[model samples]
Target chain A: MDVSDILAAHEAKQKAIVVEKDIPLEVDAGFLTVTDLNPIDVESYNEDLEDYLLNTARDGVQTLIASLFQLPVTPSEDGPVAKLPAPTTLLPRAKPLPKPKPLTKWEQFAKTKGISHSKKDKKVWDEEKQDWVDRWGWKGANKATEVQWLTEVPKNADVDFDPSAQARKARKERMAKNEKQYQQNLARAQQAAGSASSSTPNATSNVQRKRELDKTLATTRISTASMGKFDKKLDGEKKLRGVKRKFEPAEVSSSTEKSHNLAILSKLDREPSAKKAKSGGDDVLNVRKAVRFASKGKGSAALARQSGGGKGKKGKR
Target chain B: MSTFRAFILTTTVILAMLRTIKPKNARSKRALEAREPKEVEDPRTVIFVKGTHAGEKVDHAMKELMALKRPHAISFSKKNTVRPFEDATSLEFWSQKNDASMFVLGQSTKKRPDGMTFVRMYDSRVLDMCEVGVEGWKSMQEFKTAKATPGHKPLLHFASDLFDTHPRLQQLKSLLLDFFNGEIIDSICLKGIEYVISITAGPLPDSPSTSSELPKVHIRAYTTRFLSSGTRVPRVELTPMGPSIDLTLRRHQDPDPELLKQALRRPKLKKQDIEKGLGNKKKMRNLEVDEMGDLRGRVHLAKQDLGKLQTRKMKGLKTSRDDADESDESDEDEGQVRRKRRKV
Candidate 1:
């Protein structure tokens, strides 16, 4: 069989089989004619259309615009349209500007004239003046160059005048003068040394003799009052008499008095005792005896009056 | 015979003793035999002369001079006899008569409120004539009753303005310092008195003919006693006088400029060489670090390439095993499994 006839038979058989099966049919088929489909009610359709336009149509348009522009859109409460955000991604963040550098005088002039500033050259040394010179700019080459001729050249005056011969002559004269002075000083020093050496021994001997004389005189010296011959002999006699008197008896009884009178006679025969008395060696007994003999009667009356009058007057009262 | 002999001996002894005895005058003559003469010392005298028109300034000056305790300071008060700044001959004669080596003459007039005091040393050699500005003079008189200690030195103060304004004052101050042997003090305790002396010079009044003559010297002296706890009232008075000789000799002589330059010049500083050594050290250190880092980087890169090659060989072996397994399965089945895996 041809392919079309075979396919038609298979379709027929499949349809028969489907008819034989109890497959339920749809309760309502889709509309077959234009009239069977209800005509759109103009009034109700118009009302729904108006409601959508009022509620959500504007928001949909805003969303469409936002999406097209790649903007983040959010719906606002009071209005149907969404708000448009600022395009932050489109513009970069602002940064602070850098500070401008201060301009120097030369730099300011150069800037006004639209010229770049150039560096100055290093200073050069001037040989004649022995100093560094700034050779550029408005100061215009140090004045050292103009005064080069005035600098002294340090000429050799010795070669021109031959001063070595004159110097040598003056030095020889000074040497001769110095030699004469040295000789004189040497002679003077030698003479002084000789004189000093000679005088030293004489002075030493004189001092030694003086010391010996002083020692000898110190032992042999006596009192100035007894330097006379007679006074010396009398002093010796008085000393002898003092020695003799010590051996006599302590009590001056008549027996001892007779012996003392004999001793005095012996002293008077040998030498005078008056010289001893004048030399501050008077006897106390003799002095008392002399005083008593001179004022005996007069002293008794005065003594009696002085002692009895005051006592007798007090007794009478 | 024995009694007769004793009487004769006693009479002879008495006669001899009386003859040998010397008088008191003869004894005194012996004492005068060996006596040395005593030395005599010359007296130092400073005389104070009160001149014409001198009111109380001379009295105040005398008090200060006494306070100084100078060796022999004598005050001569012949009010109408000697005039202030009179001829030098009279002063010379007066000084010679008084045996005074130094003289201080004081005078004050209506023209100068501050009194004048002239100090002359070595006869007529006038040292200075200065003003003594006296304030509270009456109060100082009250303090005269109070006694100072035996050797207490009075404090001396020179006002700073006196030194700055008057050149002659500096000269006078130096002279005073020398005269006092630097014993003048700058300050003192409240128990003692403080004397502030200022000296100045002005034009001479009557003698306008001799412009070369020394200027009229004026001295202002102030005296005050400080209580332990109270404000002090100082007595101030000004004195003016003229000197016989020139005062220019008191100025300090200037030194030679060339000698000063030689003395004050300083030596130049030498340059240092350590900076070059330090720079070389830094350069050597940097070179060492660079060489070390380059060597380390070469080794690290070689190891990384070796590791990458090993991983690539391992991946190649895995891909070959997968190719063998894929060759065993049907293309359609493998495709469907891959699709299922992708869907899962």
Candidate 2:
């Protein structure tokens, strides 16, 4: 059998077998269709017909017919097409642009123009306006220049002028004129230099001396006042120590008297005759003298008043 | 009445006669040109004339200077004044380089970011301290009643008498205004003053070039701040280019918005996006890539094959010529789109 017939028969048997086996018959339909159409020319037949039908079908019946028949059922094309012929119009054609004018030779040469002067001849140009400028001093090319002096000129003045001799003569005259001026300047400068050094030294010394005096005077005044304060304090301390020492003498006298009284009492207890003699006339006489002196002493009050006045004056100082 | 009319007519005639009688050579340009090269003292020099004290009136100073009948040439600085702390040699060098004029009198004023202004006046010779009226301060402390505590050395102060005078003070104030106002026209005048000074002083070869001078002016402000223990260092730089002075302070305790607006304040820093790191981190980071650099192999390969079919495209096109042609058409459209985007 031919390949198409064999493929189709195999697809039909497969569908029947699918039905018998309780599988869906639609599942084998795609396979059966492919096998049946394998030998047909797909490009010529429009194989996308199914896709078009699926896209366009609105009614259920139309969809079923489109699917069964496998016919294209898409929407109509949007518009009809056409072409128009090319048109032309009258217009001016573009023209080539003109070239710019070239710079002149004179203009180019003027940029490099120079002015020169030599021992033989001199040529000065007017740089601003480029041209062969007349040397205000130039007479003619053959004759000597106007700057060339006429005085003391040689027969061939143009060729024989000696600039060195003229220069030397000028220098000699200048030196002679300047000689006096130079000497005056030298004297003035020497005087100024000497005065400057001397005055500077004197000014510096004066300032230094003044500074030294001021420093010494300030220090002396300060130290003297400070020393005075110190001396006063030392005198005060000495006076206080002297008063304490004087009080010590009085205490010693009082202690000595107490010791003597104790010794007399012990002697009286040991010897009756000694005690009687000691207690008798002389002892009584001393006691009476003591009482009398004590009674008459208004002098001590006067002395104490005098001493208080002195202590008060010391306190004030 | 006739006599009165005659009197008026006579007077008119006399005036007309006077008008017609001018010196014969006065109107000639050649006459004037001949005298032009003669070194004559500038009659217009206005120095201190009346009620003169030191530093009070520039006019007064000029008048005083003119009395000497000295044939002095004047040059102006691009700035009103220069600081003493600035290297003299370098400044002279820059001034000469820029073809700046030099003068006997030189001055400079610096405006701090905080809006405080400091002015410095200079001279080739030591100025008479008492003559100038203000005792020159060697250090900042000498600034009278200064908010910032100054150090030990006394700073120079402008003559109080000068400041007190209405006209003198007004002129100085106006000068300050011009400076803060950013008047570019004044730059020539400033430089002219320097030039005149240099010419008068004779030749100084060490003058700095204009290019060098400009950068120095800009950089000096920075270096000057570094030397000072001033507060509030700038976070951004504002390059101001205008005729008006940028009066705004970069730092202040309490910012005055009106002042800032008047001063024409602008920020100098540009914020760069941090998210750029995240977006390009993984894909390109492995090569430690610099996208700006040339990629030789990728460029060569891309440029070499014009109609090469991609592997994915081969499968997708089903090995068909029409499909390949359609893909190429899409590619060309994409290329056009890319070119347009690139232009944007």
Candidate 3:
């Protein structure tokens, strides 16, 4: 029996099941996606763009479906079911990236002063109990001194000076201080948000973005030779808002500004000398220290030259 | 509490006064609606505030930090002469207005230099705050490397036993988690993970030290890169994405009991969410997800009698008295073997 015709048909069916390409289509089974990295065939693309795109899409889908079938399936009541892996494709998010939050009042100061936030534990190690205990709350370490068995009374204690009561009062004051601060923080946050929302909405919009882009184009236009003086103007083009250079009024003289600059210079000169004098010596009695502030601009050596040992002896005495 | 619980009456809460506000305008209505309790809460809004005095370093640190919080963060460019410790009215007012629940306050002074405070807000109220001093800082500019995309959820790595056991470090860990946790999401693409914020404890005390001192905190930010490693999972490499900071913990405030309780409250969990193993239950009946994203369900049945089972009628099935008895015996034996295999 000549079954060669049947064998050829079988081979064709098998070949169709297996995708063969110069650069095999990259199939991400996780995302059920196939990417064709191979360069486009210019001959086919130029001939018929739509037909080429359709074929390309079909091939991608075919590859993806083939990969999906390759996944291991389990028998179920309905039939066999294949499980998919986690997606690998990165999809664009719907919302814009979140903006960094504003600095809190405390954070601003900390940043400027170079303070790192330190976490405080809720519990503290108690040396007396030889164990860890709550810093505050029921049976906390803060109330330890109040519960001490032995209490010593100071010789100058008031008649009604209750040591435990005094300690409790101080602790209560600290709690009051914290409560006050918490209330204040809440108030500030509300106010900040209220004022912020008013302006934030206007900051970004289609109209504003278009206007900004137009402004950039206008600047680039005027940046050419002759500063756009000889450039051809386009119809319906808005007037350019270029920066206007300002010159000092002809009426005003440089003398007024000159004095201001001179004053600044003099202040700068005096500040260093004053600072030097303040930090001149380790002690107040040092002659160099006294000369800077106490004396009328006289050095210790100069004072000695004027009064010899008399001035020095008087200072000693 | 001691025998003398002075001012205890002042701290007591009156739950009766909790008011329900009906916003008047469409804008306000939307704002209030967004703040409504949800099974999945929105990414917390953070407001950056400057104090009476802020230095160049503070500005740079904020800029680097802000780079990570864009779109969800608001920065007050104008310097305000507000002191949080002395007065917190401004913070509360801002929280209510902006709907911001987190804050980074930067302030520098002669007494407390280079101070930063992280304030957590609950229902427009300060839940807790922790202050730290920046001993050393390195902004993103110094690294000259690519940074993580702003607003991407950060992979927070707290490499310290203190975070789990110590109370103070635990607070910082949770605070940082909320600060960097951009949005609430269930399933995420493994490749979507971008940057990591690593915090390692500086030094360990060989012996217990005085209660006054705390070990310094080192915060390092990195952009993660996945390189092919000839395996299903790729090898991860960390590139320094800066604003690396060294910090020493200072003054901290613990949330009041009533306030902390409200902060920890979560919306009711749905049955489907619980079935996904979000709750304490380790196993659930029937419906479950098997390998990858496939969902599977078990359909149970009692033992079946194979001899009486319906089969396609064929000429061979019409057993004349010849092999009917033999075929019946074979079928029974097969059924018994099947049931035994199922039991095993």
Candidate 4:
């Protein structure tokens, strides 16, 4: 290889190995290479150049004015003020049209038929008089048929007049006939009973008469005062007042009386005998009396009798 | 010998041994993978048999059972006979022939005025019968199974009678638990039904320590039915009836106790403290603190300025320079008037 070729090869190797620090420059170079520019026609190019020069000069003037006054510059030819229409005076109000009258059904039909005459005028036109007559209160040709009750009444009408009165009269007659028949049956039954009782003499007739009496008694109403005694047999006998019995007092043990005596004697320092007698003498005496009474098997009989007497007196009161 | 050299030699020998052993393991694993794609077994079949005295109730129950859509379940009617055992044996023979895992025998008798339906569910696997007498208009029973037997649990859905008034439901529940060999869990799911007993092959789902453990068998018992208006006989009606027992296997999960308790507990309403602003005017006037005082002073100054502007004459300002000031003053007056009207 030649020296220049060797030097070029070494430079190429060094460039490939070295990293590029300017990323934007490299990207711009790559973009420039990748993009293709087409040439415009001479006439269009001249027109675009002229328009760009004019717009730049105009925009520069607008921007200078905006910066000087600190206000936005109004664009020429199509500004807001130029586009808006000039204000004009308000117009006078117009008068409202008159309302038309509502037509009746007959009048509406006449109008549809292209007739000019009113319904009243047609009804008033009298041919005999040769002028419009006052048709007020005058019936039309179909006036008689207009009244719903004007039809003929048919014969043999199904309407029943005073039905309630007729029914009441029939009911009254039925009740009177029933009452007369009931009276006649009662009289016949009484006569038959009297004849049978007079003719029969057998014992069976007597039994039959007794049965008839029993049946009549069963049907008879009993008084409320006698109702209590009606079922007396079903109820048991009434209980009598219970007798009051006396109970014998239990005998007091001697050990308890001795302990009581000892307790009383211990408390007495000056006179032991008097203290013992005063404190526990009554209890010991009562115990001896209870034992004597219990041995006889009839203790407190007198007390029981006294209580019973008092109870009897209270009951009497 | 040096420790490093010995360590290197041991490691090389171990690596060489592993290299030789890995191919055999790989070959065996490949064979297992090839054989793992065999077809899974189909779910067991259910057999439904109608008893001799089965009437409209049995037909209704049969329709409800069919609606459950148990895998390959079939129904058949038997000759009228009083012996339930004979009928059961015949049903068993037919079920065995058909390869059915469970049989539901329905017998309704006229002996009970409330129209009691005697339902006996026979499990071929356990060789046991779970008999339930459904009485009254709204008697319902629900049976749920966990992952034990796929077709063993009878499917009963949309039955009209769903109330748990029948005394025999308890007996039926015990029989079912015995057949499944599962622990019972009392559930407070519905009214009148005492339990939501679960039969799980694994640990109980409700136990605190083992709650994370999944249940293999879950049986839920409850009654649910639709309501109807009018006095028409509830019988022969195609309305929703239940006392349904759902049997699910492997789908049982632990229910949140706290959430359930919160749901069951009555809600406490917060008492609203309505500030009527009765003392607001006094509070507004007595602004002693710095933050409120500054705001109050500003308000007072604004009020005084408004009063002064209201009393001042508009004709006093006549200079052209004061034209802008006059306009601003007028705008402020208008704004103050608007604010006063809004306050009023």
Candidate with maximal lDDT: 3
Off by over 4 Å in 4: A1-317, B1-44, B77-82, B86-88, B110-126, B137-171, B174-344
TM-score of chain A of each: 0.14, 0.13, 0.38, 0.14
Per-residue C-alpha lDDT of model 4 across residues B128-168, encoded as one tens digit per residue? 34433432121233323222223332211111011112222
Model 2 DockQ reads 0.00
Residue A295 C-alpha lDDT in model 1: 48
- How far off is residue A214 in model 1, in Å? 59
Query: Where does model 2 sit among the CAPRI classes?
Result: incorrect
Give lDDT tens digits, candidate 4, residues A42-84: 3542466324322222222222212222222334443311111
What is model 1's interface RMSD?
A: 57.1
DockQ by candidate, in order: 0.00, 0.00, 0.01, 0.00
| Per-model TM against the reference | 0.22, 0.15, 0.43, 0.18
Per-residue alpha-carbon lDDT of model 3 for B118-160, expressed as tens digits?
8887766777888877778888888899877775656555544
Who wins the TM-score comparison? Answer: 3
What local lDDT does model 4 show for residue A186?
63
TM-score order, best first, reads 3, 1, 4, 2
DockQ of 4: 0.00
CA lDDT for candidate 3: 0.66
User: Where does candidate 3 stray beyond 4 Å?
Assistant: A1-317, B1-28, B189-191, B207-212, B289-344
